[model samples]
Target: MAEEPRDYEALMALYQAEKRRREAAEQNALEEKRGREAAEQKLRPTNLPEFLDACHIHLHASLIVQKNPTMSTQGNPDNAKNKLRPERLERWEDFAKHQMAIWDDIMASDFASKRQFAPLSALEQSGKDLRQQKIGSEIDLHIFQRDTVDKRVSSIIESMYYNKELREKFNLLGTVNFENHANMLSPESQLEEGMEQLTVHQKGKQAKEKQPSGSTDTAGSSHPRADQFCHRTAAFIVEYKAPHKLQLTHINNGLDEIELEDIVQDVVQRKVDDKDDVRRLVAAVITQAFSYMVNLGVEHGCVCTGEAYIFLRVGEDPRTVYYYLSVPEGDVTDTTGWTAGLEGPNRLHLTAVGQMPARPSTPSCGQAEKRHQSSDEESGPDPDTPSRQQSLSQPLSRTQKTTRGSSSGRGHHGERYHQIDRPTFLALMRRQLADDLDTDCDPVGRPGAIGVLFRVRLRSHGYVVAAKGTPAWFIQRLRWEASIYERLRPIQGIYVPVHLGNIDLETRYHYEGICELVHMMFLSFGGNLIGQHLTAENKTLVSEQVKRSADAIHGLRVLHKDLMPRNILWNEETKHVMVIDFERAEVEPISAKRTWKTPTGNSVKQGQTGPSACTKEIRRAMTELNALTIVIRL
Candidate 1:
C-alpha cells in the first residue's frame, strides 16, 4: 500500500555507508595536509645555521651598497652613472668567501669552546682595511669610516645571535635601497645609504650615531658608562687598565666606607658586634650577588674581569670596599680558581691562616748536641714528679668508686664533659684496638684532628657509617639513633643508617656515611632537595619535593619529622635524593605514640602509657634525635 514499505533497512544501511565514507575521506585529507605542511616546513630553511648565513650575506651586501653608493647607481650607468668596477666586484666576492669560511668555522665549533668575541675575529683582521679602501676611492664617504664598519659588523652579529626575529624579517636579500632622506640628492643628506639600511630599519635615524667604528685598538677596555643601566640591589663596574691590573667598584646602598668604618670602629673595636652581625653582612652581600647573577642569566665564572676583582657598594652611603682576591700567581688553566675568586672574601685560604708548612731551617751539629744534652738532663724525673705522674696515670679503682658513691654521676644524663683533647681520644682508641687505623679514615687527610669523626662504609648501596668515641654518656645516647635507623631502613628514600653494631667497649655506635646517605636521599626525596644544587630550575624541584613529601605521608604511611635542609642530601652525579637522621620517623601505626616536648616543659604523649610505652619511647627518641640533627641542605 505504501510503495512496498520503501525498503527501509536497505535505505538506512546505504545512508550509514555514505556517512562513513565521507568521514574517512575527511580524515585522509587532514592527514595529507599535515604531511604536506611538515614537508614544507623542512624545505622553508628554518635551520639556524642557514638563517644566520643568509643574514650575514644580506648584511655584507647591504654594507657594500651603503659604503659604495656610487656602485649601486653606476651599475645602472645608462640612467644613473655610478657602477662597481670589475676589480672591486672580485675583491667583494673574495671578502664574502673569507667571511663565509670563518662563519662556518664558528658555527661548527663547540659552544663550550667558542670564545665570547669569536664572531669579531675575522672582522678585526680585514674590516678596517676594507673600510679604508672604500673611503679612499670615495672622498665623500668619510661618514662611513672605520667605526661605521665595526658598527655594521657588530649589529649583524648581535642581531643574528641575540635578535633572531630581526634577522629573520628579511628572508631574501633585495636591492631596492630604501632611502628615507627628505632630499635624495642633497649634499648634506641625514641618511647614509647602503649596508646602513638594515641599521636604519631596526633603530631609525639614530643607528648611524650608534654604529661603532671598527678602528678602536682597545674596544675590549671600553666599559659601559655608569649611566647606561644597573640593578638597584647589587651591581659593580670593574675596569682593567692592563691584563691582571684592575680596579673594582660596587654600586649598592650597603657596605659604604663610612658605614664599614663605623661598624669596624664602633661595633668591632668596642667588641659589641658579635659573630651574628658579621654573618648578617656576609649573608646580605652573598644573597645580593647571587640574585644579580641570576637576573642577568650569566654563568658564575664568565662575567669576572681578567684580574678577578669584586667590589661591593655600601648601601645608604656613597662608599665602596675593594676586596683584593689572593689567587695563586700562575697560569690559571683551570676555571675553578676564577670561580672561587668571584665568591668574595669568605673563601678559605690555608696559606693566609698560617697553616701551610714553614720553610725548614738548618741547625748546626754543635747546637743540636747542646739541645740534646739539655733534654737529657731535663728528662731525669725527680722522686716527687714520678709519684705525681704515677698518681695521675692511675685508673680509678673499685674502692675509689665506692668512696665516691656507687651511683657516680660520670655517665649520668645531662652530664657535660670539658677539656677533652682530640689527639688523646685518638691515642686511647689506638691503644684499645691494638692496630694502626687506616690513614684514609681521616677527613681530607690533613693535620688538624679537631672535629674529626670516623666514616664507615656500609654493605647496602647509598649508605655510609659514621662514629665518634667521645664521652660514654654521649656514645650511649647514639644508641637511640641506631634504633631509629633500624626502623627507617625499610622505607623508600629514607637514608637512615642500618644499626650494624654498637661496640660499648670502644664507645662507638656505627652510622652510615654522608655519601651514601646523600645518594639514597636523592633517590627517595630528590624532588624536594634537588633545588639545593640546581639554581636555575629550583622552584620546580622545591614544589615537587613538597608535594611528594605530603603525598608520601598520606599514601605510604611515612613521616619525616626532621624535614630540615641538612637532613636532605642531593647527589650531584646521579641526581638522587637521600633523607637522613630517621631518628624521628614514625610509621602510621605508631604515629599516635609520637611524643614531642613543648617549649613550656610540658610532655606531649601520643598513646596509652602502659600499652604503647615501648613504641612511644622509640618514636619519641627518634623525634628528639631529629631535633638534634643539624640541617644544612645547601
Candidate 2:
C-alpha cells in the first residue's frame, strides 16, 4: 500500500492534524505544571515582614500576607445540594496544590536559618498606646489591660504549621470528643436506618385539612421529609472546623431550671395575652437579630417559636442575641414542640406568624386572627405554616435583590477556607507570638465583629495572640483574611503581620476546658501616621511607601478594599509605613497592560473630597495618601 505516491493535500492534512494534537498535549502539560508549581509564586514570602510590620500581624492579625491561590468552598442552603460542583472541585484541587507547594518549599529551603523573631519591642506593663489617642474607636479599652493577653495563649499550645505527627500531643485535652459537640444548638437529625436524599414522603401542601394535628401521613408526599436535607444546612460554615460556642448568657438567668425555650414560651404567651411590655421587648430583640442577619448575608431560618429560644443580652444598640435551636425534652410547649417548625413549600412561616405589632383592636388574639386570614387563602395552613408576619419579615422582593455580604456566597469565586492540623498552625503562630506587639482598632469595635484587639505579651518577646471574641459573622471575614495572608505570607513585607496561624490548647489556670477558637495571629507594631508630624523626607517616604504597599496589594489581584489612614500603619522608629486591616478585602482581575493618564487638578483635588477616578484597566482610582493634606494644615 505504501508503494502508491501520497498526494500533497493528504500529506498536508496529516501534518496539520499532528500539529493540533501536539499543541493540545503541550497545553495539557503546561496546565499540569502550573497546577504542580505555583502558577506565579509560592505563598508565604521567604523570611517576610521585618520587625515593626511583623508585630501588627497580631494586632490586626491579617496585616501580613503573601501571594497564594484563593480558596472557596461549595455550599447550598439546602443540605442535599451541599456537595462541591465541578468548578468548586477544581478550586479545591488548586488550593491543595498551593498548600503542598508551601510545604515543599519550606522542607527544601533553610527555613530554620530565617527564624529571626526579633521584631517589635517587648510588651510593657502599662499597655499604653505609644502614640496617644485612639485609632479606630473600635478597640475596647476596658479589655486593654497590659497582662490580659499573657493570660491567653498559654505555654502548652502547639503550632499547627510545624507539627507533622499529631498523634499524642492532644492527650492533655482528654479524649477529644470529636463527635460529641454542639453546633448552634441544632438538634441531632440522625438518619434512622436508611434515609435517602429522596425520601418517600406521604403528604402534600394541602394535607392539613383533614386532621387537627396536621400529622396525616400521605403516601409519597411532595414535600421533602429528609431531616438531613431539610435542616437549612450552611455547609460552608463547617468547612473550616464548624464554629462552636461553648456558652452564652442565658436570658432567664434568675430562674434555676429555666431553659432559653422556656423564656421564649413565657414571652410568646404574654404577647398572646396582650402583654404590651413583653411584646415590645420581644419584638425589638427579634427585629434586631433579623437586621443583623440581613446585614451578614442571611435571609431565613429564625422564627419566633417556643422550640427555638432566643437568649438575649440586651442593653445597648449592639445587643447579643443567642440562637438556641431546640429545647429540652420537657420544655416543649403547646405553642411550640418537636414538630413545631417552618416546613413544606412556603417556608419561613413560623417566624412570620407572631411578628406583626399587636393591633389594639385585637391585641389578645392578633396572631390567631392573622393565622385564620393566612389559612383561608392557602387552603390548609399547617400549624407550622409561615405566617403573614414571617413572610413580611423576609420581604420576598427584598431578598430577591442580589447582595454582597459576609454570609452571602460569592458564586463565581466562593471564599476559600483552609483545613490544616491545629498543631501545624500553632507552630507558625508560636513564631509570630515570639515577636508580639499590641494593636488596637476602633475603641468600641467594628459593626459586626465584637470588642477585639490583639494584646501584646508582657515583657516577653514571644508569639503574639489575638485574644478577642469574634461573632459567628466574623468567622467568614476571619476565614477570608486568613486565606489572603496564608497565600501571601511568603511575599516579602507586603502587609503587616496579618494572620499567623490557628491556636487550640488546654488552658490549666483560667479557662478550664480546652479553648475552642483560640486562632493565633501575629499583629505588627507600627501605629497609623495620623498624630505624627512629618518632615519633607518623611512625607516623601510615606507617600512612596503607601503607593508601594497599595501596588503590592493590587499585584495579588486583591483590593485593600479599605485604603485609609486607620488601616495604614506608620512606624516613626522604622521610618516606613505598612498596610493593615484586610477584614473587608476583596479579589478582582489583574492586568499587565498600563495606560498613562495626565494628572488633572480634579484627580489631585479629589484627594480631599475622597473622590475616586476610575481607569478602565486598573481600578486604582482613589485619590488618597496625600501627606501634605493629612498633616492637618495648621
The best candidate in terms of lDDT:
2
How does each model score on TM-score?
0.23, 0.28
Q: For model 1, what is the error of residue 181's alpha carbon versus the real structure, in angstroms, after optimal superposition?
A: 77
List model 2 lDDT by residue over 1-634, tens digit each.
6634567668888999999999999999999998766522223231212211222222222111111212211221122121111100001123223333433433344432343333233322122342232221101211221122111111101121233332122122211100111111111111210121122221222221112222212211221121110011110000111001101122232212223344446667864343433333333334333332322222222322221223222112322333333221123222221121223231111121111110011101111112222111122222111111121222221110111111122223223322223344345445443443222211111111211343333222232222332333234445556566554554423344434443332221111111112332333332333223334445656666666666666566555544544445554444455565555555542222322111111111223111132221123212333433333343
Error of 1 at 336 (Å): 39
Candidate 2, RMSD to the unseen true structure: 33.5
Candidate 1, residues 238-299, lDDT tens digits: the string is 12121111112221222222333444345446654454354234323333332333333222
lDDT of each: 0.28, 0.29
Residue 626 CA error for candidate 1 (Å)?
22
By TM-score, how accurate is candidate 1? Answer: 0.23
Identify the candidate with maximal TM-score. Answer: 2
- Models, CA RMSD each: 31.1, 33.5
